[model samples]
Target: MFPLERQQKIMDLLKLKKVLKISELTEELNISVDTLRRDLNTLTKQEKIEKIYGGVKLVESKFAESSMDERMVSHLEEKERIALKCTEFIQDGDCIYLDSGSTTYQIAKYIKHFKNLTVVTNSIPVVNELMNSSVELVIIGGKIRLNEQSVVAYDYIFNFDQLNILKAFLCASGITVEKGISDYNLEEAITRKKIIDMSKEIYVAADSTKFGKDVTVSIASLDKIDVLVTDANLNKNMIQKFRKTNTKLIIAEGP
Candidate 1:
């Protein structure tokens, strides 16, 4: 792998494992010990990571602790662009599922432009956005997460088998070619898993920043997604990496 790509792989590994020994990094990256040390030194100088006695750990990131409102505005332009591109997949009279996320909430803003659409979602913000729109809205009911502004239908009583979700637009905290898609919350992951199983086409809407990252809960493998919608801000290297996978990627152009 190229130096930049190798460094990114190191970062990705560190995100998933939190900390790693130098030997582990060398083995995982298939690089020499000297090369691994060089990469670690670079990351240290960039203030993105810290080297321990024999291992390295990522620096604390503000993005990890951000609230729903903060996340909503974190990458506003890119999220908006991604959201608009996702709407192009929807057609009149389609039963679509919108997974709870800041990016998907932007999709709700364009709900009025469609005709005879049945919108199913777990996002409170999406529900509010479509409250007065002409499209029919169905909400997945369960415990509501105040910080995420999302509802998790974890109880067995809530049946997702009945819903014929034509297209599912999902969001993820982290997505990678090897690890697939993941989220920080388990309950929300459970809810998304159910919806994904029923949907004909799974469309994951995530900003470019989400790439090369992994979180706690595994939602599904990358192959399960029919298409991944991301903004043009995504690096070319990541795009090339994803192209090697089976999942189709759609890059939304910016203004």
Candidate 2:
């Protein structure tokens, strides 16, 4: 297989088992141990996976699962405003899952005050914010992606599968009425799809600026989103587009 094909397969395998031994990868890929190690090392540097003593493992986190710092700085204010409104869905004693992104990071800040809740996530920043909160914080163990400073892998999903998620707050790089929600990074896309699939009610926290954009990977349909929280700058026609579906859209006034 070509390098891209090989890398895709490796990503697939990581999703299945969360961890891979170098020898096992060599046998499966019909490559030398050195080549397999090289691949693993390259992926590790990219923050796609973690190189353990004798194997590799996927990064496990729910929020900002694969993003870089530059993207986080793009729309800080809009994200925070939407995140504040997204917190309305969170209640005490609820088990919440937050997918990582610049917007979702704000959601973390807004929900930290809820008592007796369990915040499950894979974002390093989210963990940093709520680590001292009264809420129960369960950090999913996995490899860390450097670009997004988020975590991905079956390891996180396996744990999320065991939980009863009350609300899942997600963020995306793109949200189109026709094409649905999208994200650029492959690692982020996989984890966001898993978040929407595994949660009971999916709450999307995004800015109005993201409305017409579409990206490489389609993670969720606009129809599948249970609630959308955004700042008040949304155009009227677009609001009608979301209204065409049963999805509940909530717009917040500027902060």
* Per-candidate local distance difference test: 0.87, 0.77
- Best-matching candidate per lDDT: 1
- Tell me the tens digit of each residue's lDDT in model 1 across 117-226: 99999999998999998989999889989989999995575788789999999999999999899998889899999888989999999999889989888999998999
Model 2 spans with C-alpha error above 4 angstroms: 1-67, 155-157
Candidate 1: list runs displaced more than 4 Å: 1-65
lDDT, residue 43, model 2: 80
**lDDT (Cα, tens digit) per residue for candidate 2, span 128-235:** 888877879876666688766778867634565777777888887778888888887787788778778878899888888778778778898877889888878889
Cα misplacement distance, residue 211 of candidate 2 (Å): 0.8
TM-scores for candidates 1 onward, in order: 0.76, 0.69
| Backbone collisions counted per model | 0, 16
